[model samples]
Target: MVLSELAARLNCAEYKNWVKAGHCLLLLRSCLQGFVGREVLSFHRGLLAEAPGLSPSATCRGGSRCSPRARQVIKCRNEIMHSSEMKVSSTWLRDFQIKIQNFLNEFRNIPEIVAVYSRIEQLLTSDWAVHIPEEDQRDGYEGETGSYLSASQVNEVKIELLKEELEEMYLQAEEQEMLPEEISNRLEVMKEFLRNNEDLRNGLREDMQKLDSLHPPNPKRDSKEPGRETPERKD
Candidate 1:
């Protein structure tokens, strides 16, 4: 029932633009979530930027920062849903199509749907991108649309992180350079002292053995020796 009505609306030129755009956005979101396996409404383009090189570090740190384009798309989606007239301009439509195309391109080979939709976008006419920007002028502009970081702020944050890494390296280098020579010298001295003690101990043992051989103990004399006399018998 739903697909029949969808087909009928798609057949109509007037509703075709909105229907196709809506379907494209929906499919795009689904593909993104299918790849990310998480909510993207909060961090649409930011998540896309990180999704291709998805890492455990990124997954553990869950908050997503929105990209400028993703913010614009979100605004466009919101305006369309909230407005009573619900119309868009050709310029905005083209931009939206490009945005979705770029987003889906990030995860090209991972999801089959992404490849299918990308080809579909290429084959389909820009008539699908026929909406006008003026129609949605009341919604918001680039700077005013969504809550996203300015390019300057992002740069500043990157610089600060780099500065921290550099600082850490400098401290490590300073610690290593300060005591390496001193520690090595101390180790060499201790080894030399131990070698000298070992040599002295060996020399002393040899000298004692030599003296023992030179001065052998006097042998016990027998009672019948000529110089020996027996003492008178005693009780």
Candidate 2:
């Protein structure tokens, strides 16, 4: 198929599985080709250095340069021999063929992908399983005892604490009681002191207001005063 048509097919939901399979295959092919190309180039560079008058630098630069006639010959040979080699039997080629067949099988089977995903998920969740304790085993005696405190028992403890606090307050107050008559006399003295202070403060405030009113400003003081001089003439 044309590359554009293949790309369009890859975009369709119906062909998504095939597209993903093909993409993976293409990536693997590209990586293998790159690795093989590097190996071939290295070998060819070394081979070229053995040729007459070719230094390592010259070999590295001119290793891939071939004449147009040689290119046509190589292309024609590849076209004729490459397709026929697919049916040929050789040990290394058989292994490669088997691998390709297996890859194609896995690519066609969606269950293989699902199974792989499931296995990965299982592996991930295995850590979670390891963290969780078995039901038969108690976590710890201390934690179990702490967790065993019932709601009613908790409330009873709180009530007992409050009762003890109240009793202590009562005993302290009983030990430190004030005399009744002395307390009453103190209360009466405080009332008298507060009333006297209020009256004194009110009197002070009224005096301040009266003083302020008596000291009202006089703007014509210079003219009204007996020793005041009038303005002299400029002449």
The TM-score leader among the candidates is 1
Model 1 worst lDDT run, 10 consecutive residues: 137-146
- The residue-by-residue lDDT of candidate 2 on 8-94, one tens digit each, is 322343232222222233333443455457768988776876785666555344567755543543443233222211122234333
RMSD of each: 35.8, 42.0
Instruction: Show how many residue pairs clash in every candidate, following the order shown.
Output: 7, 0
lDDT of 2 at 227: 72
lDDT of 1: 0.46
Off by more than 4 A, model 1 = 1-14, 38-63, 119-235
Write one digit per residue (lDDT tens) for candidate 1, span 103-171.
556556775565567544842343332222233321112332222223233223323322332343334
Q: List the residue pairs that clash in candidate 1.
A: 88-131, 88-132, 89-131, 89-132, 90-130, 90-131, 90-132
What ranges in model 2 sit over 4 Å off?
A: 1-14, 54-235
